[model samples]
Structures are given as structure tokens and as C-alpha cells.
Target chain A: MIIIEILRYLFGYIEFRAFGGFPDRFVNLCTKEGIPLWNIKNAGGRITACTTIKGYLAVRGPARKSGMRCMALRKRGLIFFLKRNKKRVGILAGAAVSVALIFILSQFVWSVSVVGNTTLEDEYILSEFEKYGIKVGARISSVDLKEAAQTAVTENEKLSWAAVNRKGSVLVIEVREITVQPQMYDNSKPTNVVASEDGLILSLDILHGTAEIQPGSAVTAGDLLISGVIRHRDGSESVVHADGHVKALVKKKETFSAEDFSFYKLSYENKRKIIFFFGIKIPLGKSVPETNFSEHKSFLESGEMQLPIGIITQYGAVYSEEKTNPELSFQDKAALLGGAMYAKKLLDYSEIKTSSVTEKTDEFGKHYEFYAECEQEIGRLQEIYVEKTNDIA
Target chain B: MPKRKKQQNKRKNTPVTPFNPETKLEMLGNRELIIDGCKGIVDYGENYIKLNTGTVMTGVCGDGLLIKSFDNEIAVISGEITEISFVS
Candidate 1:
């Protein structure tokens, strides 16, 4: 318990706190070293030195004979006098600063990093590992690096295997991502092209085999869009498989404007953060005014192998709200609406091709409308019409 | 001259032990001495006797004693001597 208190006392110095009393031995040694009498203060107000060089002479009478003044000073606690003799605050601060600096220097990882992975993503792996104490600036000795790294690898599905190693202060993690191979299908078997969804036929191009449907034909689900049944002129049916690219003119209609009264506006906010140890929080500064600010926050945790040491870098969005004013021009509102729609589209898909753009204006607001056609080759699922098992049977 | 003659007679009567050039012996009392050759304890309490040339001692006795010599040179033991004889 005393040891803990001592540590706390020492740490308090780091926080710029001064505890009363001089360290007994250091003061005594300093006194013997002839470190000016005025420079010394005992635990009590003994006043070992006075500017009147003959200050020691004042005790020559009855007080000196009995040594009463010295005794009284000792009784008053000589250590406290020494404590007052000098600037206790500066000493405490210096000691604490030195200790803190040494401790931080000792605790810091000589080297930090991530390992043990391919495919799951290096950044993803590193992010998860940051929570484990194996990150940059974290004290290496105080953390169970191996345990944290291993635990992280086991918990994440994408990382099939992981191991962490520490060499000095450097943390190394070796990992293996989950492996997957697409299921191979026998392409030699004849198959027919079937409609994946019910839609009016847009366009079809049969590279090999025969087309069963024409343009503008309304087709239902499971209907054959292309047939692999090839015919022989000799009155015999030879079913040949079909393989080709099929394009369709599918119509989709969607509203492209947000309600003016309910639209969310993102206002950039700058928050100043003060970092100390593992804790981080914004202590001051504002990115946006409170009236216009909307709070948004997200947290992701990550760490090394088996250890739980990691960091959580929180994401926050502060948005501002402005009152709808008549000053906002129609053209400006149209452009903003277009930008919002485009942003929404970009968020939903990786790529978009704008086929056409249209504008609409109403009493509420102005909006830009668009009729864009996008072609995305989703998957390699071939339709089956004739079964190869039937041919063998 | 008389002291020299007496010392020579004493040497003729005493067996000469030659020490290897590398031989050395340490004694107590924090003192070190090198000898041409001397029999019996090379070092006594607080005394050190060492041989750098070629010399030898037959017996010795004391605290903290050691004997060492180069190959085929000499040896100094620590103990009291029961017999002493001069060898040609």
C-alpha cells in the first residue's frame, strides 16, 4: 500500500502537484555540502540562515546554552522547513516531468505494425490490431501482444489464420485470408437462355444458338429468352446449347428529389482534440455552429492477434441546418438537387453513366430529373432449358 | 665480502630449485617476492613469493598458497619441510 502511494505521489508530480516536506537525506547532504544557509529550510521554520551574517550570534545567550530554539525547530518538523526553503512546485514538476519522460520513452514500442494476412486487407487487419497494444506509440512491454493478435485473427471471419510475433519492441503478425474458388460448371452441356426477371424485351444478340423471343415482347419469369434447340432440315430436332450476350431495354422510374423541408445538410465542423495516453477527446474548438450542426458519430474497434489491445478511432459528422430563405435562387437549388442525386447514385454503385438529364420546378423547390441507363454484368448464371441427363437416358 | 661468502656457503649447502621463467607464487600480507630458488613454503601468512626465472621449492605451508611453472622447470609446494638435501 505504501509503495502504491509512493507511486501515486510520484505520478502526482507529473501532474504538477507538490506534496509538503523535503526528502530528509537530500536536504541534509545539501546542508553539509555548504549549499548556502539561506538556501536551506528544514521541516520547520528554523531559519538556518539570515542575511545578517551574525544571525547565528543571536542565539549566543540563554537560548544557545539550552539549545531551545533548535529543539523547538526540530519539534516543528525540520523537513517541512526544508520543503519551504526552495520552490517545491518547480522541483516536483521537474521530477515528475523527468519521470514521465523516462517512462514514456521506456514504454514506447521501438517498432509497431501488423502482419499475418493476405486478402482480408492490410488496412483492415491493421485497423483491428490498433486496439491491441501493438500500435505505434503504445508501450510495448505493458501489453500482451501475442494474445491480442491471436484473438483478433480468430474473431474475424475473413482472416482464416493469424499469428503475432514480438522482436524487441517490434510486433509482427502473420496472417492468411480465407480462400475461395468459384464453382466450375460443365459448359459442354447444352443449356437454354431463360428470362431472369419479368420484363418487356429490350434487345437480344445471340452469338451462338437461336433466339426464341423478339424485341418488345413481354416475357414472364422462367420464360425462354433464347432457345438452344437447333433444328436439322432432315425433320430431326438437334438440341444445341446457346451462348451469347443478351441486352434488354428495361424501364425503371424513380423520384430524384429530397423534400426541401426535410433535407439534411452537412456542415463541416472542426473539433480540436488533446491527446494524453490512450484517451482522446475534443477539448475545444467548433467545426460548425450549434444551430447548424447535426451530430454524427461511428466507432470501429481493431487490434492485433490474440490480444485485445486496439484503438477505436471514432468518426463524427457535424452538419449545419439553414432556414429556407427566398435568397436561394432557382438555378442554385436545381444544381444542388442534381448534386445530391448524383451523390446518392455514386454511393449506391461504383460506376454510373448519365444517359439524360431533365429539370422540374414546383412551388416547393426546383429539381433536376435524369433518365440514365446503366449496364452491369452481374453474374455468370447460365440458363438451363434441355437437361443433359435426358440425352444420356 | 664476508656476508657474500657466508651467503654462498649457505646456498651450496641448500638444494637449488630452478623455476620456469613463467612460474609464479602468491602469498598473503599483500607482499610479492621473486626467488632464484628456495625450499619449503614459498609464501607464509601475508607474504607472496613468486618465481619468474627458473627456481623450485620442495615444501611449503601457509594460507592462500599456489604454485605454477613452465613445462619441465620447477615447482614450489606449501608446507613444512621434513628433509632437505642438495642435489647436483
Candidate 2:
């Protein structure tokens, strides 16, 4: 189709009609100008001459000499070039055939891609598309891509939202998987105090169950903070596990350090671009001018053209990345560690946080230390202290 | 540069006859100019109009009229003047 437009523009073909005796005068004038006489065709009373720009000038003199009037078959300034001495019959037929072929090929699907699929594989999603006749090389114009995509997304119980996009020759199927939490069940089992971490208990509170330890109590791993038991007024005892949480204070001590070497540098580079014909890449821009460049690229294959409906053609760009890293100074290192310490504080509410520092500056480098006392929540177990008769409330 | 030379040659060739309403001056190259009643050529960048030889016709050259000599050649660009009668 594009080739035909280019040919038509290059050839500058125009149709001209003459009334009265202008046609014969024009033919005679053109013949005198070295133009072959057989090139002029007589259609009805109007004579159409396929001649070059030079031949058109040859007819100008005779046109002025004779009072015969002439008008171009097409509008003025519309024709770019007129093909001199070429057969027009076969040219028109060939153009029609080419346009028809392009129109027909535009109705089919060429490729399908699935994105955002973690547990569900791309093959599985494509198989679902096949069930709806949305596979590669299928006629996409006739299929409802939205309906099929919605049905496919709902088919999986894990998917919350699904979207299908048709761009050019590529079909993009995006699925948003639904997150499910573990189901909780009601059970009648003894609730024991479980140690969240290996820490010594500093304080404890017992509202219903018996107190297992007092303040400043030293406890090891998995030491019970409170006992889940009940004493009735009838001199009878009924032991029931706690259903609510209890509060406690514990001291946690941890130490960490590193004496490793790290290097810093900057990166600079150029990335390449790809040229495509139809839906295929033809490797256009590869050899770049520089080195030491970090590059990342993403391709978009979705519906930009609608002939084959949801089929998309992939167009991509390469992004060259540049990074800079500088060596840390004494102040800069302290500031960096200060931000890290703040982040650590956000993770846990430390009661008393402190840092012990020692600096050694030589040809190598310098280092420091950071220590913190973190106050955190530790779970406790409690039971009802009321008798069985009071359980009615 | 060549175009400039051609223009200079054309100006040198055109004759400046006296304001005769009936006569017309035609220029050839820088070498020659012709009036309705006379035939002559110019030289270098000077204002002289020398006539061809062996002709009864006559006209003013630089400041005065010069008669024809017998040894001059008759050519196509320079022709013999016909109907050289005085106009009122």
C-alpha cells in the first residue's frame, strides 16, 4: 500500500480533458515536441494524455494559438506527476490488489503475552486464551478481547482483576492475583506461654492467672509468665486456658559488627535502539560510541493497530543508566549510620539506645560502633478467676 | 565573472545616437552597434562608433561622422543600411 502511494507521487500522473478541437491541437503540438502520439488515449469525447512535464509545455503554445478550451480531468494542483508513456490499466489493478491484501491481513491475531503472572504460568494463561479462539494467528477483529479476558481472569479463584489490551500485533493479558490469608479455626486446647524471642523478663502482670515470677525476675527461654488457672468458692478448682492477652517487660541484648572492605565508583554508558519492520525487529542501532554504561530496556507489545483487532506489535527502547558513588568522609559516614539507626528505631521501640564509638584513621579507613536498648511487647497468658456460677455473666 | 563581462560587452555595443524619434539603435556584442541608418563597431571601453568600409551610408561615430573605407569586410552581423532617409 505504501509502495503504491510512493509510486503515484513520484510518477506525477494527471488526467486532462479538452473540449472542442483542443484535443487534436494538443496531440499535434505534443507530437511536434518529440512526444509519441500513441500515448494519448481517447476515453469518450474527453482525451486523456499521459505525458511528462515537458510534453505539457509543448501543448501550451498550440492551446494559446487555438481558441479551444482545456481542463484537467482532476482538480488543479492535485496531481504531483504524470507518468509519460506508461500503461495505466495494469497499474490501477495492481494497486487495488495490494490494498485488498493489506486489508485482509489486518483481521488476524499474531501474538499473545501474559504479564503479572507469578503462580499461574504464562502458558496456562495462553491456554485459556486458546479456549476463546484468541491465540496467535487467529482473527482478532471477530473476538471480544475484553469479555474473554474477564472470563479468563474470573476462572482462577486467586485473581482479583484481569485486563486484556490489544496493541498492533501483540495481545497483552494482565492478571492481578488475589491474596488469601490462612483460615482460623476455634479449638478447645491449652494455651501455653510461648517465647517470642530469647530474652530475660524484667517485669510481669497477672490479672486473672497466678503470677509465675516477680519483678527483676531472671527467666530463660520459654519461661511461663502467668499460669492459666481458676479457683471456685465451693472449694473446687476448674483450670481453663486464657483467651485474652497479658502485658510484660523484657530486656533484649544483641551485638553486631562488620570489618569488611567496600569500593565505590561511577558508571557511564550508551544504549542501543532497535528498528522494526511490521512486527519484527531488524537490528538497526547496535554499535554505540562508548563503554562503561548500564542499560535497562522494556518492550511494549499491545494494540496500536486494529486491523487484526487485539494483535500488537512490540516497540522497545533501551535506557542507558549512569550511577555515581563517592567515598564517605567521617561526618558523612556518621550521618549515614544515623539514618540507619533511625530506621532500626522505627522497627522496634528501644527504651535506652546508646552507641559506643572508636575511630582508627590510617592509610586504610575508619569505623565506629552502635548499641541500643530496645523496649518491646512480650505476650502473657491469663484465665478467669471467677467461680463456675459467675460464668453465666 | 563571465556574466559580468557579457553585460559589459552588451553595454559597449549599444549605440547612443542623437534623439531621433524615428531611428532605433540595436546592439550586438561589445564589438558592434547598429542604428536604423548606420552600421559600426566600438573598441575597448571607449565611446567610438567606427563604420564599415565601402558603403555610401554614413553616421556619427565618437564626436563626428566618419565615411566608409573600401578595405572593410561585409559580414552577417554587420549589414548594409537600406532606406537611410532623413525623418522630420
**C-alpha DockQ of every model:** 0.02, 0.00
Candidate 1 residue spans exceeding 4 A from truth: A1-108, A116-123, A130-132, A137-142, A181-191, A194-225, A232-243, A247-262, A266-268, A276-316, A320-330, A346-354, A359-369, A373-393, B1-88
lDDT by residue (tens digit), candidate 2, A234-272 = 988656564333333444333222233222333333456
Interface RMSD, prediction 2: 26.9
Candidate 1 chain A weakest lDDT stretch, 10 residues? A13-22
Could you tell me the C-alpha RMSD of candidate 2 in Å?
Answer: 26.3
Error of 2 at A81 (Å): 19
User: Which stretches of candidate 2 lie above 4 Å from their native place?
Assistant: A1-98, A101-188, A194-226, A231-258, A261-270, A275-279, A282-327, A335-367, A373-377, A380-393, B1-88
What would the per-residue lDDT of candidate 1 be over residues A243-294, giving only the tens digit for each residue? 6665554433444553443345676544333333332344344333444333
Please give the distance, in angstroms, between residue A301's alpha carbon in candidate 2 and its true position after superposition: 10
The top-ranked prediction according to DockQ is 1
Weakest lDDT window of 10 consecutive positions for candidate 2 chain A:
A305-314
Candidate 1: residue A80 lDDT (0-100): 42
